[model samples]
Target: LIVCTHDLAVTLTQRPHHLIEYLARMKKRVTFLHLRHLYEQPRDKGSPYIRKKVKIGGVEVRAIFAPFPSPLLNIFRGLCVLLHVLLFDKHRYRVGINQGDPWIGFVFYILRAIGVIERYVYEDLDYNPGGHKNWLFKRITEIAEYYSIKVSDLVICVSLNLLRLRNRWRINRVIYSPNGVHLSLFSRAIKKKAHPPTILYIGSITEYFGLDIAISVLPSLLKKIPEIRLIIAGSGYYLDDLKRIINKYPEIKGHIIFLGRIPHEKIPDLMAESDIGLAIFPPSELMHYACPIKIFEYMAAGLSIITTRGTEAARILKKYSVGLIINYSVENLKEAILKLFMDGCLYKRFSMNSLKFSVKHDWNKIFHDEFKEIESLYLEYVLIHKRTVS
Candidate 1:
């Protein structure tokens, strides 16, 4: 059982897709129940939304998201969370909260009231949304983090940096499960290329992702290679900033395009239309811990990648010999893109190597591995519960 604040069907994040796909494949042996705030919750409805709780293509599945309420209407959401736990057989269900917000305390309070969910898992996806330097939010976050770590049976963090907090709470089951991509989807994208020499960038244009780097480099790149076109496939708080940057560069004014937000399934088509993928996250302490899913998607599409150094994605590229890793300078990026076009053998090698490497790390296969471990843990939990009850 998975209990989260975000609607699985309406909002598409990596976590929802991972949970939905995993449960769908293992439904015969595993029952899944996804809980969310509500289906009507206002969402970006663009690149941010991945999948929904609704059945896809008439497939009836148990991993469904139940919408509760927004904070304003969540005065009694605790009871709702409790009622769902009571509705399910305790021994057959495992509870997990996708987002570790302070309000989740209300959900767990309901779970504790019913004595149905024995173990709770908290997933920490981000360290801070706004700057961590804000005193009030920082204090609130610290307190919330403390409480979550103290109560949770397991804390599944996406980065190793989060693991540093494990010692403070005496938690032993902390695990690192980085974001991943669907390799099969990318393969199809590469196979069906609609645009030649296309350049694509998908994901947040936030201060962290450094879409500005691409915006700065693109004009010069276009000057060198007039046929080049760019596709910016995601949106965030920094979209306006990125637009300003792009507009400042007259050479790339008409060559660059923004697709706004797109569906996860639609990404492959967009990737297929591009020959090169860009991931130019800025140089910051925050970036050192990032594991961008776009790199894998780029590799799967067989596109030569241009990205910054000091990221897990760069390490993977280096290890697999799939793409070029470079610094975050605009001059370096421009030079790299030019080299990718001029050096045919290197680009071909990177493209072929990327396609081969991406197959090994597809989310479909990764989901199986994670689900198997979760199932084992669930069974172990049941055995311990029975022993205590007996």
Candidate 2:
């Protein structure tokens, strides 16, 4: 399989990592082509291309971290993919993962057309255009995504809403495969620590995640549990804004700890120390069709969740009773926070429920079932064609 993604799997563990890792464990011939942007690349760079055996959570992430002599724009990334297939890897792949950037998605689809790969699997992780604010980039991605979906042999959507939306767009080959977590990597449900009943908010520090609203209510939460802590991991554009919001309440200043851009390996330790795993994506079109991987990761860590309505995380909690859902308000946020930390029995129940839920949503199990279903469907379709010919 040839996997193409914009994110460096070795650094930030994401959707592509799980599938690539699964393929590697199965001993398949896998060559991953990924991106390393200007901001992320080293200052004294020797070569533009970096192909090495990198590891995530101690498991090897074999890849060609490709970026040409310029910015992380789609055009350059597309050129890198061409270089990788033509001059670098030079081997035909059975499965071509049209994963990450839309520019690469079109390239992979073309590769499939030319027999560079036998099948094209379009990974509809997110509506890239919807997430982008730039008009030109959005239009480019929208066109690329439309063509990719039309030409793909199979399409995997990360959420049910996305699946339905894609199907409505006339994609019959699409299926739902929500974001999953590596069970072995994330230590599940360590007993609640005695000091500082901690609430953890990890992943991209973006505005839509609803952390600001959660933090705004912290002053009220402090009235009951004065020593309660909120540890925020990961860096994003919203870090400065979040800090400004935190500064509004100087009383809760000591309670907040910011550990920006954590390594993948250190995440489990953070989870182990945390009392609650937090995800609160506010209502939006993009978020509505979103499946937050953090929800599964939190469950894998056996930490109870507190999320907002109209997200996949909320639906998961609604089904499993693993946590509470709050509207985008200070009062509800305060109430939900108190329940998880203050109510021992309820917290235990939610923790146990999360543990059980995590097992079912493990990356290994999810991929196994998904691949099995794909194989079965292939076989059934082939048999029908044979019968028709006979």
- Which structure among the candidates has the greatest lDDT? 2
The per-model lDDT (C-alpha) reads 0.66, 0.74
Off by over 4 Å in 2: 9-11, 39-72, 134-140, 373-390
The residue-by-residue lDDT of candidate 1 on 91-139, one tens digit each, is 4336555354444555664564566565667765655422355666566
Residues 130-229, candidate 2: write the lDDT tens digits: 7766777668778877876877778888888778888888986888888888888786345444557898998888887888987898898888998888
Evaluated at residue 356, the lDDT of candidate 2 is 86
How high is each candidate's TM-score? 0.79, 0.85
User: Candidate 1 at 277: error in angstroms?
Assistant: 1.5
Clashing pairs in 1: 8-52, 9-52, 9-53, 12-49, 12-50, 37-68, 38-67, 198-275
